[model samples]
Target chain A: MNKQTYFKKFKNIKYPISRRGLLISFMFYSFFHFSRKLYANGEIGGPFRDRFQSFRQTFRVEPNPEEAKRIINNIIKGRDKRNNLILLNAPDIAENGNVVPINFSVNCSMNGNDYPKVVHILVLDNPFPEIAKFFFSNQSGSADLAIRIRMRQSSEVVAIAEMADGTVGEDRFFVDVTIGACS
Target chain B: MARKNYRRRLKAPLTAKKGEVITIKTMAEHTMEPGVRRDPKTGLIYPRFIIDSVIVRYNGKQIFRSRWYSGVSENPYMSFKIKVEESGLLEIEWIDDYKQSTFKRSVINVLDNNGNEIFPIRLSEPSQSENLQ
Candidate 1:
């Protein structure tokens, strides 16, 4: 139909309009312009700000492996025992980077003296690479863990475990991206 | 105040035999709200909403745990393997940064070496647990 005819027919429709409809239409149109401005200004800053703040207050360093190691090492400085380590990597080809399944098992002796005290996983290249930090006691028998993570791109994944006697261990994995995993 | 919504689902078998290493798949409905998006009406930034941690337990004992970040998607899905040994219930609990928590439970049936259902146990109700703090 021609544009003029379409407009005429639309206006002549025998449906009664309520004030709510007019108010909604006006709000919708106003929102369209408002959203355009927001997009142009790029004012988006989600939960990442809180994450950044937390990292800054806790570690005072970037969320990279080297930085993480330094921070963790400082926490265990002056200790005498070694820590067991396991490196976990995403699959060679991830279908989605946003929610990639990553698993790591630390072969630690479950004995009272050698049990793992904590497990920390870090992604070196993500916007916020610190994926998870798990603290365990002797009761948590095994040091094996699995989790899903969001990846911005191909990056290195690292896992670090601390033992009861101050021993520290480490693991690393490389992830290749076939698809973006984060929105 | 904005209303928050979250949900989770399991994709693995609900029953397994003792010592059987089976994969458990789970996904949750979440906004994973980064708090970065601007309100089209007010032009103000939204608050952040994301899952921070999850724990899985069998018969009152923790078997799996994890901590997540904002990089995760709006609705997050996770898969992991657990070796069952006793006839006990399976439970999963998820918590967000806002101090909100949700729990899900499923019955686990322990089987014999011949794959016979020998023992069936129901997991605890996560919502009713006082350990959520």
Candidate 2:
């Protein structure tokens, strides 16, 4: 059976349908239409019928918890192990959110398969959850970095270290922002 | 289009011991616009303008790299560590979204035991002249 023969056979075959079957299918379609109208009118989904719209606009806001979770999940994939391998140092209170000084160091010797390949920084409440990513080589003695980042509000800063080996670790710190930055 | 002048700065220890880790700090002036702010009068959104990546190379070999998003504050400052095996030229490059790249370089002299500077290439050896047959 070649593809052309199969297509010719399908074209020759007829799907037999009775008048009663057509009438039943029309009724089913009408039922679906009515249900759709009810859903649009907020009667089907009850109080949370507008959740879909809210979900669509989830990435627009600064404090988007769902989007942050999605970004973390995408980064870590299935390897979600939290350990002390990564130490994230961030201020407990930042007077100005425009520049929050933060640093991170990985507890790994720069030996064969002990160093970190990439380290990710994420601000859970920022509009863009992923703040930065650092890539280190063996010549990079220490997997440590210090930088300044902007935060829209007080949020948990997460640092995830993906080691050269198949291991991953993360650390989180909460910082309170007295004045948030508009980004 | 007229481009704005961006100031770049790089600092590293001028001298260090062999097999020692040294810290390097780099700073670049950039607006780092997040593209979400609106103008007060025109209500126009500003386009995103930021440094996309930073690469650190020692003796022309890359040792460290970083990718920055708009979350990085204006005039970004970053510091990291690298192990020096020999004296070499260190370069830090900043690449922005506009495909413009700016780099700052510094030379470090690595000293071994007995306070002797180590050079990547032999300075005392002379090259042999090519012989034609």
Candidate 3:
């Protein structure tokens, strides 16, 4: 549709009424539907993919093993691996970087005999990724915790849970961040 | 007045099993202004004002402590687990770079899973005295 017709058809729209605006709007409006269609057809790389590619280029943080090791050293200190009792829950693709809901839970009985001593969350690519450290005592009664954190862009999220007996448990996963919360 | 709007909401079970593990969730409302980010209009860097440390203590024993940087997102939300040793107090302290401090306290009670109070076994109990006699 022509820009004039498009604008007139959807009048009262105060902004983005030019030809470029109309095209951009049309693309933006159909991005989700088109992406869905591509997935349904078992195909990849649609119009939205191109836009995301550019976004990735601009806000990408390449995963570095060395950097992750550095972070582990800072947080976990000496012990890095122990048990697979920790869960790091995050979306495969973050629709909004501004408000990413991330939850990290340590699977250990809050019983006096066993419990998590501390839990730490780190984003591999954040400019300063040491998000937070959580300490737990017996009175806490459970080792479950949830927290929302920000990602600079697309990077790996690491969760490490250290038990009172010095047992270490951890989970790591990557998240594709679209819009950065740091901005 | 501005600081008043910045708030913290903590959710935890009022009671848990004597040794049960329960989850605690918290959400804090704050701008988390990164000192590095510049105001678009004024072109001046907004001073860094982020929660610098969060310490949680249970029954007067330190359980959790975190040191933070400005990279933390705004309105931080965190969850973690702990064992319930006994009925006691859960105290949370938050400090920011601006030297502002906030404290939040919640009372926690411990009982059996069936909701019965878990009484400690005392050596001087009446039943124990009768058995001794």
Best by lDDT: 2
* lDDT of candidate 1 over B44-104, digit per residue (tens): 6666667888898878888667777666666677666666666667788999887788988
As a whole number from 0 to 100, the lDDT of residue B2 in candidate 2 is: 30
Instruction: Choose 1 or 2, whichever is better by TM-score.
Output: 2
C-alpha local distance difference test of each model: 0.65, 0.82, 0.69
Preferred candidate (DockQ higher): 2 or 3: 2
DockQ of 3: 0.24
TM-score attained by model 2: 0.77
Candidate 1 lDDT over A107-180, as tens digits, reads 76565687667677767765465566776555454666566677667877777777777777776778887776
TM-score of each: 0.60, 0.77, 0.65
- Number of the top candidate by TM-score? 2
The TM-score of predicted model 3 comes to 0.65
Which predicted model would earn the best DockQ? 2
- Worst lDDT run of 10 residues, candidate 2 chain B, spans B124-133
Per-residue C-alpha lDDT of model 3 across residues A51-159, encoded as one tens digit per residue: 1211112232334556556557655657758766898888999987767777766676666758877777877776555666676666665556666677768888888
| Candidate 3: residue A82 Cα off by (Å) | 3.5
Q: Could you give the DockQ of candidate 2?
A: 0.37
Writing each residue's lDDT as its tens digit, candidate 3 over B97-122 gives: 76678878898878866776654445
